[model samples]
Target: MVIRGAGRLTAAAVGVAVTVATAVGLVLTPSSAKVEPAMVADPGPPEVTISIALGGATHGYVNPDVALAQGGTLTIANGDGVLHTVTSDALGTSGDPLFGFSVPARTTRSFALPSLAGGAYGFYCVFHPGMRGTLTVIGGPVGEVPAPPSFDQALRIPKVLSGDHITIPMKKADVRIMADGPKTTMWTYGGSYPGPTIERRAGQQTKVTFVHKLPKDAGSMTVHHHGGHQSSADDGQPTKHLIEKGAKRTYTYALRDAGKPAPAAFNFYHDHRMHVTARNNWRGLQGMFLITDPKEKKLGLPTGKYDVPLHFSDRSFTASNQLSDPFGHAAHSGHGGMPGWMTGEHAPPNDATVGQRILVNGQYAPYLTVKPGLYRLRLLNASLFSAYDFALSDGSAFTQVGTGSGLLPAPVTRQDVLLGPAQRADVVVDFRGKAGQDVLLSTIPRSDSTGTGSRNAALMQFRVRGTTSQKARVPGKLRPLAPLKGVPGKVSKTWTFDLSEMHSGGQHGSFWSINGKMFKASRMDHKVRMNSVEKWKLRNTSDMTHYVHLHQEQWHTLSRDGDEPPPWEQGLEDTWRLDPGEEVVVAARFTDFPGVFMLHCHMLDHEDHGMMAQFEIVR
Candidate 1:
């Protein structure tokens, strides 16, 4: 039993209990936790029995269609010919996989769901999306439900990169992080704390002669390309190999100059190692990959006179020690997050009160003075897992120009927008101002981590400083992005991910996993042909929402977040996010990878907590 995402602190306890029981073939019961008293409130309607079927021919049933109490429980039955797992992201349901009952075919399995409040919950099968069901808690005031994340109109802060002639020393330099500080090692690049930022255009290959720079280095780290193409050996993955301290290793990968034609939108580089990434990135070793295109330059979009690179993130730290990862929740990270953070009901705080630092391009409370004309922002969400909904301090609309697929066919003006764990949006904000007026650029507070809802807090601040020209105007159209042709009729092979589980303790913490397995460092699951296009249909059957991510391939979303494929998604990609209960159909052409690649949860903790698996691309 593994809980998929337990926002509740019950994750640690639950995980420990299940692991022991599995090994002994007996359930280990722990004393129920003492409950804190809550002032009473209005009751919700009785739940109706909603019968759902899993595995087309194999159907499982869940009774009591809806759960209305804050921490109520529901009983589910397994009636399918095959085994079934029931999981949710309700309050205490961390990404544990034990809450699930693995009833054999023809037998019945029962599961008791513990407490789920009034908001909508996401549930899915780790086996198949075709095997999905939803439990909508009704009887609440309409507005109480969070509004879906919107592209509400707002102003855009100008964008800028370290626009520099980047040079990775031809010779490898041994380096180490200085942890002998008041707190943990402040982040560093190359060798020194806060490793130097590298800036370059697309179509350029960065040659890195990597050398283990740490003394007694027991762990490994790699430079990950945050862009779409992640297949080449250059894409970071410790398992691929390691460069030892004092020994030099060269890694030369090309970056298509955005100023010319390119393979991806602007991207960034960061370390993706487990456990250590959160600490390293928070300390400031993250940098941007600025890709410019002649097509974009010709668009008459906001140019240098008004561009800004606003890297937004939320972090919590004390004057000396950065607050440790919340016992279970992952605030701003993709790896080593506890399963508890993914499925729990603990909504993230909206203000930066508990958190002490905010950096924009590596500087605290970064102040970038802007000109009054139209300012284009190359916004980056470099935080580990914190998501945001943003708008101008004063209500204003911002023109959206590009996203995962690059500049839309035209400039799209939207209100508030959703920036998920690793998603980005390029916008143009026109500041109609006196030369030195201050305009604060910020994001809203957010609550539910599963869906695009809730405004967590103000993500950043931008001040309008320089003079403006009345001559600036936002064109109705920016660039033309056509969708790629699909390989629909060719359904070579199909796979489904039914997210079910609430398991506890093992070597890794309890977590939500596909089938009944967590991510094992040495396991390889799927073997495929490189360059073969296939369809993967994903469905979320758990109460909590899971962000499913794939490595070595950035696939296209067939349908999701109300986005239908325009002419662009027809090509290939390396990542696609799947929301709960929502089915996303995607096609990918894996042209590389002689060995296995990984396809798992984007929620890093869930991946580390055993919510991951491997896929091999062979001959």
Candidate 2:
């Protein structure tokens, strides 16, 4: 009998037959004609094999239900980059597992089910309770197996805190990403997943005191005011001014651009520890920071309740609803391939960590009720590695009025906005005539061929209801942006992003790097003259996409691969996406305070690895 394993089995068993025939000749003797009957051994029960794997984010298990003969084999394959298990639910208690065998990532295992009785049994993964399946035992050959809900929760806007002197406590709290999901423990700012929105007027001096209340093992914390023009002491360098556990540290922001009121902008604050930046941010120590210039009130954009800040991020949880370790064996390498280093050992610092679930404002596919009018949406991509191509479900256009640092000179109409990690876009979405309709804010699938991109498409929903008498329109001219002056054909410096092989602590692997060198705290890669405008060329030589981010100052994109930048990139920007082998030229005038600042990939995993460098501004 031949045993075969396939993704699906249409029939239960394969049959084997043996035929015996005796030929008699007329001239043959009786003794010679009588041939001994060939003895045949009986073939017992035929064995059937069923093959299944871990489906992508959307589908929990490829074949959730399957039938197998009483005496057959079950082959389990884990195609994902993460570790998963196939355990009988009937053998173990809720939290204490007593039965299932472990299956490492990117491996296959076979189990014999001959000893089990002819009945139905349930199974699940020990790491992920959400992953469950059913297996049935039949007396005969197994036949074909059979196959396999939406967002209705209200959006939870982060609590707003506005004052010159604000205090936020960093502590662990129990929060729920999905309305019906289990409670997840997260390291939050002021006990919230997104912390609190810190709103301040431009030109005002604000000081925020962060009290470190997380467990001692949480390590020292540093708060980075992303996109802020602050001094080196407050820039949140990995080793500068850390807030130790049970201690407090204050960060001061001038909120000014060279002694003048800074243009109204959207920024954010998050943890930026040295090697744990990715893990810290993934645990939820981030929030939105808004700088408002009273002068912009004349533009008449959406304000008050009509203005909304949507923070997008992706995460994965364990069976107990705790954040999964991005570098752990059970965690999925967001890059879609296995880590270059060993599993169950020290993590490969360069691997990208992508999550299975996408969230908006800390809620899983939540909904926001809106009035029939124009509203301003402040969009921020806070995820560790994923980049979202945001679009409306109805195929409506968004009037983009602002880039990363501040408002654009004019509103550019865009059908969809692509935001890399740590990038922000301010757009005006009009729902004027679409009352009583549910419009979903969804993301386009990633075009890159690296990893299995996010399966969750819908980020949130906009439930347009009620009527408003006010008519708001995006102005043709929103602000004045003076282009950075730079001499043509003169390049100040060029930075290349690539991957380099390194041997550290007896482990050898390829790590992300800038200019073929890993990050060194004592090394400075570039020095720029203060208040001098210079053009710089950025290049990506690696095989994967990268989101390049510069601290302290926002720059203007001069050209992308020798072509003018897109409408959304025409404004002052701090982060730029670089596909494999793509190059970009940008110009910026170094001003204000800049002692030692960082320039690196915004993908937190890449940043945490060695794909970062430091620069200094000299007078």
**CA RMSD for every model?**
12.2, 15.1
* Deviating ranges (above 4 Å) for candidate 2: 1-148, 328-350, 447-456, 486-489, 503-507
Q: Give candidate 1 regions above 4 Å deviation.
A: 1-185, 190-197, 215-218, 228-232, 245-248, 256-261, 274-280, 321-358, 434-437, 446-455, 469-475, 490-509, 561-577, 592-595
lDDT values, one for every candidate: 0.45, 0.70
Query: Each prediction's TM-score against the native?
Result: 0.61, 0.75
Taking the tens digit of each residue's C-alpha lDDT, what string does model 2 give over 464-543?
Answer: 99999875677789888786666456889899998776554554555678999878999999998888887889999864
Quote the positional error of residue 53 for candidate 2 in Å: 21
